[model samples]
Target: MMRREATGEAAPRTPQAGAGPVPAPLVASAVLGGAALLVWPAVFNGYPLVFSDTGGFLHQTLGPLMLWDKPWIYGPLLHAFHWRVTLWAPLAAQALLVSHLLWLAQRALRGTAAPAAHLGLCAALAAASTAPFTVALLMPDLFAPAILLALFLLGPAREAMTGPEAWYLGTVATLGIAAHLAHLPLALALACMAFLLGLPRGRALRDGARTAAPLLAAIVLLLATNWAGHGRPALSPHGATFMLARLQADGPAAAVIRARCPEAGWYLCAFADRLPMDANDFLWASDSPVNRDAEGRARFLGGALIAPEAQAIVAATIAEHPLAVATAVLRNALRQLVTAGIGDTLGDDHLRTALRPRIAEGFPARERAAYDAARQPRGVLREAMMPLAPLHGAALLLSLPLLAAGGLRAWRAGDAVALTFLAMVLAGALANAVATGGLSGVFPRYQARIAWLLPAAAILLLMPRRRS
Candidate 1:
């Protein structure tokens, strides 16, 4: 009574006549049900899918370091999440993050949703699509779309968010963008595109800064991490080298090399006489001059002399063959969107031969047994999902128009939340496609990482708003 009098506050009221609090058993059931839904893929497959690149990631932290051609944060994050070789912890953490992002997205456009609704939609998504597969896999692909999703929340739907919610969204968005080097540029591109489209006219810029700040922090974190781990002062030095590969496949870079090789004492000049015909051949074949097994690759990556030369060659070739280069980039982007296959590179012999021993040194025996018994020894992605590929392709093709229609409807009605989400997702998909397909070359996994959004946008577009 004295405490109540001091604060002038009333005692809490009980839930009314017959209604008590929610049952603990029901809450537990809901949680368990949600987990089962999200990780059902892992259960269906008996274990998480391990891609060919999984070993490269595992090796970075569990074994000897490898000079992976991509970003390095993914490996250390795995080690941190591995929880002393429990093995399943990382994927569990990924699932949690994915679920959280889905929750945020459910509310992205001032769209109100109960916790049950968010869980149910995620459950539906996990069962119907490849989205959950990424969460359970060891690859960085999931983070790509996750980044875009977070950016959509932070950039456009920020007005609908609380102060703490903004901070959470910003942190997750940064981590997601920094998960892959490709994502780094993709985030900036999306932001720039949004600005250009005049979507961020008012408080959009101020709130969008919330998105930008985290990406900036992530870049700094990357440069510092690379410095500590790989002695590099910048993001991956493989960009020019990768562009060289693309140009080599385009035919003009090789032609230019042949013309310049006679007097150039470059190692590539020596191989001009026996040049490989395509990007994969030039970059990965045992006979390629730039194969990691070959001296050319080491020399090129070793900060010696080849990278700058490759950059020069790429620029010169582009100057000479702009049309061909542009054509290749366009073709690759188009092909990426339609590419339906997923997880084709689920295993590699190199991981077993060179990486597994190191894992054994630190990997717990129990988890090792579990891994081998389930995900290991190689298996193909089921052909059943193959039919769903066309649907994925068609949804992506339709995302933009859905966003435009929704945005227009919201604009006429003055719903900032709907307008923001529509514009942001539309911008994000286009940017993601350009960064992955345009830079990394056409790969199904790259495009599929964000294709779920096409359907998601379509769903959001059709959602009826609350009456004012």
Candidate 2:
């Protein structure tokens, strides 16, 4: 028998090793796959500036990059370079982000013998579901997937994180929040997952606080910048009063207001326009005439409003029909989710046409009109899907099951990564619902907002596993 040097005992032979090095071919394939995704737009050229919101986002983000007197708060990376560079910036950023997500999938499935196959399948599903829509756009949709991947990669799993990993996760969380308020829910879900995944509660809370501090600071700084840019607070009392007045109006008119303005700061008018109104809606007929009155238009344009009167009217409506108001809010949240063009330009073809004559550089009228007409089918489908829209409300109604499934899966067997993902899907769905109200006539891009969660849940359900 072989004896140990010091203890004079037989040396024990190690059992067959379970974990293996990541295969070189797998690494090469992943790198190649990522490269393909990065260059997909240039190669295909099928969807350049296709989404309606792309123009606005490009203008907002690239305008600041060019040192134009536009608000930079909306585009955090605006100061990083010249706006002209941003013409290609979205493509490059999206490519890099897609690459990173592919890398994360590799890591998530690292222990599996066929990590490449696992990652390839994940990528395929992600692409089929939402990755295509996101990477194809110039809007913040790409950031959603990037943030989710960052969370999955940096989030604490069954294993403990190294100091660097913790710091990286924190940074990703901060950036995710700053990217868009919509991303906050995912960030929160990640934080919860970290705690549930064996991280000490105190440490988890501390990490969360550290991660959130930068986002809060950035938000404050952005608010200051926006105030300076606008020459006023983001939302002035007059603006608020005007918004309240608009909110008190009926839905059809509110839809018209949103169609015209499309700016969040003018959200009140948009909200009011969305209020449910029949053909003979006479409650706010006085307000309707105000739209045509020069003095009334001047008051609205100048942001001077009868604040108490508007508030009193809205308050009275709520008081008289509390349940109805609550129901409306809920319905609006649902509307917001499946609505196509609430915050986009898809349905704003009329507005685009109006601006075409005034602006030397704008979408060509013919193209804009065609795009608007093309959107009708999507609108019809949305209306047709109205009965099925509540199926999405499962995110709200069955939040507990999803949460429990996600939580339990993340727990007992250390397979909760899927749960974390589903949590985000549900959170985003709920947030969109709350933010916008039920399906507006907008396109389906908003549904892409939570696209990451779909494949994640699918992976959880589809992946073969030994029973615990």
Candidate 3:
């Protein structure tokens, strides 16, 4: 075990082998109780929260149609859990995954595998951070943080984990990365960092390769699913369309269009006058060029239809205005770092239009009724969550200094565990910000989903070190 802190904190005594084993019922109860607390927001909201994008996930399997916008893995997972009976099943699954990972994280970090301590960690996170809110939502956003936690377990916390536990975390990390397109780069960045940090030791190469294995598997799984569903073996077929909107919102695409239009004869030149619109508006607005034909007629799957052009536009814009693109990306990433809030997760008003029809079409009558009666759809969840925004803000604000102190202490003490934990939390958050904010445009939920790790790391850092 690493050296304990010299703060006069007594080291916890290790349990004797094969002695005082926890009863089976107690372990089950601990997991259930912890999961329940982690998903309290859904219980409070009277339903699992839904997003405008939830319909896209549902469509992947429920519609049996390929969505150009995202990967197809989450759709089948949602189907397996819910089976169209109730959305609660999937929420429960998410909660359980989160709960177990938290248990593992607490056990690995503080060297205390007690159920009560695990529940306490969950309770603290549920009260002060965005864990419950993310878990409650039926979106893939929760997996972003889950992936980071899972990576930490497989990397820094690997020494403390048993074989089965390592496999479980590796599986969770793989699924989490495959669940979202943005997650791939985030995981790769962290895994690469781990490799770089481990350079001094011969085992570093082995450890880095082990950590990266899941990412490689996730890529294969993503491609296989995409091939099965869309007949195209690609990560995201319409990614360029989204990128074009982001660049358009950020100014580079507009500058390129204005400078190269007419003579360039790009399809977007028709709308050069409206080049730099909000990313969301560019993608979803009725009158937006991407959503309309040259004659101003509405088109289904218009984004996908224009993806080739979108890709060209994105490439040209990046090439033509490299400095502007970099500046915009940096600006967006910084904005996203501090933009963590429960903005639209609790609110249903903005999503009702696109979300309602999917529920009507994909679910049974009883499930539809449940959706209609949920606090989110009735505009109550956001109001109930309004007070929590400040709490989350304060928690994150306090975590910054704690993490800085912890990082400094870890560096001075040459503590690999503390350093790896700090690095994963901070780097994952920043990489997420850059991936989602810079490429997809800034949304609070993008960062909010992962921001809980800040407080989680801070709490773990403060705990006295003990042998596992």
Q: After aligning candidate 1 to the native by TM-score, how far in Å is the CA of 463 from where it should be?
A: 3.0
Where in model 3 is the C-alpha error above 4 Å? 2-24, 408-414
Total backbone clashes of model 1?
0
Pairing residues by index, what is the TM-score of model 1? Answer: 0.83
Q: Each model's C-alpha lDDT?
A: 0.64, 0.43, 0.81
Tell me, what's the RMSD of every candidate? 7.7, 10.3, 3.4
Which has the better lDDT: candidate 1, or candidate 2? 1
TM-score of each: 0.83, 0.58, 0.93
Candidate 2, lDDT over the whole model: 0.43
The all-Cα superposition gives candidate 2 an RMSD in Å to the true structure of: 10.3
Q: For residues 1-468, could you state the per-residue lDDT of candidate 3 as single tens digits?
A: 444465322232233221125565766677789899988888887789888788888877778877777788888889999877888999999999888777667666656556676677778999999888899999999899899888877875676676777788889889999999899989998898778766654347766886798899999998898788777888877789998999989888998888988898788888998879999988888888988967989978888888988889889988888999999999999999889889777777556676777778877898888888888889877887888899999999999998888777766765666677788888999999999997788889999999998988887776665554
Give the lDDT ranking, best first.
Answer: 3, 1, 2
lDDT of 1 by residue, 379-417 (tens): 333543355555545555665576677767766655555
The CA lDDT at 47 in model 2 is 26
